[model samples]
Target: MKVLIPSFYLILFLLISNCSTNETVIEDVTEIESVYFPTVDGTNWETKSINSLNWNESQLQPLLDYLEEKNTKGFIVLHDGKIVIENYFNNHDIESNWYWASAGKTLTTAISGIAQHENLININNKVSDYLGTGWTSASIEKEQLITCENLLSMTTGLDDSIGDSVLPENLQYVTDAGERWAYHNVYVKMQDVITQASNQSWSNYFNTKLRDRIGMTGAWIPFSDLSVYWSNTRSMARFGLLMSANGKWETSQIIPENFINEATSTSQDINRAYGYLWWLNGKNTYHLPQSQLEFNGELIPNAPSDMFAALGKNDQKTYIVPSKKLVIVRMGEAADNSNFALSTFDNDLWEKINLLID
Candidate 1:
């Protein structure tokens, strides 16, 4: 089915173009920055530019070599805002675009924050007001109560689930606004909310605020090979930087602090570790294993928590650990749900660093 690009979305692109009209050219390009991931279990940190973030490029040297040995696809790390580790096995590169899968939900949700800041939409505002006629509300819950806030928290009580491969649009209004914890496709389809509310195409909204602003330079391809959105392997690391910095990019506040708090912090009481569309470690479902697991096994139940992440199927990830002042990213085939391919890699990477930095 073809998605009808909303006129509101068109206006946003025009606005972006207009900003560049007088003296700038808006081009869709990508960049990969180096990052350093040091571990001390402490927040105090500093940045020093170097050719590489030479900590544990080889800590799991055998493991990395092994994955490549299998012709695996992608992996990249951003430590302390510098690229510490990166490589492609079979299908990967700076321009190699891949699906964020469920990770796309975090990104799309982030753009909603941008839309709010731009005054194109309001998180507290009801969806019915903006969606016009095509919108439908079946729940007894007043459409007025169906604010963008409800959608972000995954409390809309619809049948949305990450485990399920597909969802219908009706999930948006299946019950009272905040009665359940089902992950709904309505969150994604709420692009209609974004579209109707912000009056912008999801792509344009992402390109303008997220991709273009922070230099994600990746395509948001939900469908169409190379079509959902495209970017290189390292392009994802930039997103980890955005969350770690709390929406500020090089000093500018790309997203409001409140939005970041709401998005990364679990909004629904039902899932204490879910925020917006991102998964947090403090939640029960995020327990880490040890020995080969050997991680600190800490959870961030509230703000200032150590680790928050945008995780997706097949084990794609952009992890933000504020306490360590680190952002790590991994893209790969789902090896096991118990420990995504990056689990041991994450633990070993930290353990190796703790040996030096701590």
Candidate 2:
């Protein structure tokens, strides 16, 4: 049996098998680039050095001593878009303003998807066509079967213990619109239905369609029957870095990448963790807020299941996690069993932020 090969090694083994099949067809046509949008002007955000991402800065003072024993006053994370971590605790720093109670309903669902991308408004119409028909004591054909996509997916069956007062005798009717799933306060009356379908004045349409086009200072004041937005935790991490860049700020778009991907993904199927007011986090199941109880899994089961949050009422947070491009912010007061937006201290603050980024 003889072995014969050399004809210049058979053209060098077919040129190393066509360069390993053209490097796996150029790594399957590449493409994973878009995410660095910081330039809102206020202070030019850009800071990254957790020992250059080799991290483990001994897991940073035990994650700032577990956010100063959970009474944290301002903490930030932001990764790919810069700023590794930021802290403030107790005496609170970084210009402390705070108050996104109800996480400003995800900034009024990104200013009602920028007032439906400037056509002025239409989350599938009908919230009595911009506050008309007796607003909501039901019976006007169940208040024209409520819409504005059932007030951004809390499924306007209404009645979440009639608490956050939208007035027409506390917006009653507990079972009609889209069956049931409650997180009420009638979502602050969808800011008077984007100030009557954009006659402009929900703080001037959220400061000209989103806090003066993203410099996001913040206001929304009057809180008692709902209306609190406040600011200054780096303006809520610049609105969670403009929703972790999906609502863009660098190349502009400003909020309408298909309406922040349908306002952060899942809108409604009776709370598959919710969206349009953004909460979602790997939804298999979830429903809370004066509970009709469903809770199956992943609402924040220790974060990063493509995490999305706005969570407020004393645990005020931001957290946008595009597979770890991450943007996290936490503002002060009430964590020891906070309520309104979620708490078991949000799975113990994502298990101490997964022991500092796992």
Candidate 3:
């Protein structure tokens, strides 16, 4: 009986030790499963296989086929900051550079945030403070009311009907700033604000503050009066990943987390699905560009509710879904006949993505 008692105690000790060991192992694995960040100096990026993710591998081919059919040039899906699906079609390859069109506006948003964090600029300050008076053709009294935040939120109250030009003459006042939301080119002027505040060229400041920091290779090319940004698909993905990480690149807080949260959230009441130059999904209603009409519905019905995107003309998209830990980049020609940022293609594309990820 004495021998049996000692054996039973030994068995209990072994069981407790094994359980404790397993608990420690689980904690270690969780810590190791952190989001991956690609090296800033090289072309090397880690990839994860669909089978390893235990995703609906069968749905992947269909998604690729659909993208190709829709004139897609490049498509990428990053899960936990690691590439899960990367493809190029229609004569496009990994090295190809494409214009970001309106999606580039988000770059301005991020730069503005960084500038504000550096105390170089204040978004709440009147636009005239940076650009000086008469920057807009509005009466000085009305123009004085336009703040940098107004531009970021598309509440500039500038007449967008003057066309997509930010010249002083084109920036006519329509109403008091913050009284309405109109997606206009006036937001581009924020770049000038940044340049003037930082006392450096826009490109130089952007490169030093953001591009180089995140290892993104892109140039802001002046197209007519508009400044358009262009970069390779992976660079766009990197920016998206940085945003998904809440403005962090590895350990560096390239942009303030509070600013990122504010930028992704609804910045104004007129457009529930619009942020600071970013488009949000899962809102109860949304407003589109060039139109004041309010459409009642989620921005993209099939996409995850937490998804916010940088959508550009000709279908340039960088969709960040925090809940799913995904940053999806799609750069290509228009998926359909629509030339606007939001189109029928978004819903249809999400339909396919839903199948693979669900």
Local error of candidate 1 at 68, Å?
3.5
TM-score of 2: 0.35
Question: How does candidate 3 fare on TM-score?
Answer: 0.92
lDDT of 1 by residue, 1-358 (tens): 3344567885686687777746544343444353433222223224443234344334456656655653347776556676555667775665677766666677777778888888887777776667643343354354456667777776654444333332333434545777666655566645766766656676776787777776665666545221244465656777777777777776578878788887877676665656787777755543221111222433433323457777665566677777766766666665444342234444443444344333
- Name every residue pair that clashes in candidate 3: none
**Alpha-carbon deviation at 333 in model 2, angstroms:** 38
lDDT of 3 by residue, 171-289 (tens): 99888999898988889989999999999999999999999998899799989898899999999999999999999999999999999999999999999999999999999999998
lDDT-best of 2 and 3: 3
Give per-model TM-scores.
0.69, 0.35, 0.92
Comparison by TM-score, 1 against 2, better one: 1
Give residue 58's lDDT in candidate 1 (0 to 100).
40
The per-candidate count of clashes, in order, stands at 29, 0, 0
Candidate 2 segments exceeding 4 Å error:
1-43, 52-105, 110-130, 134-141, 144-153, 157-179, 182-192, 201-204, 213-237, 241-276, 280-295, 300-356
Instruction: Judging by lDDT against the true structure, name the best candidate.
Output: 3
Query: Which candidate do you rate higher for lDDT, 1 or 2?
Result: 2
1 or 3, greater by lDDT: 3
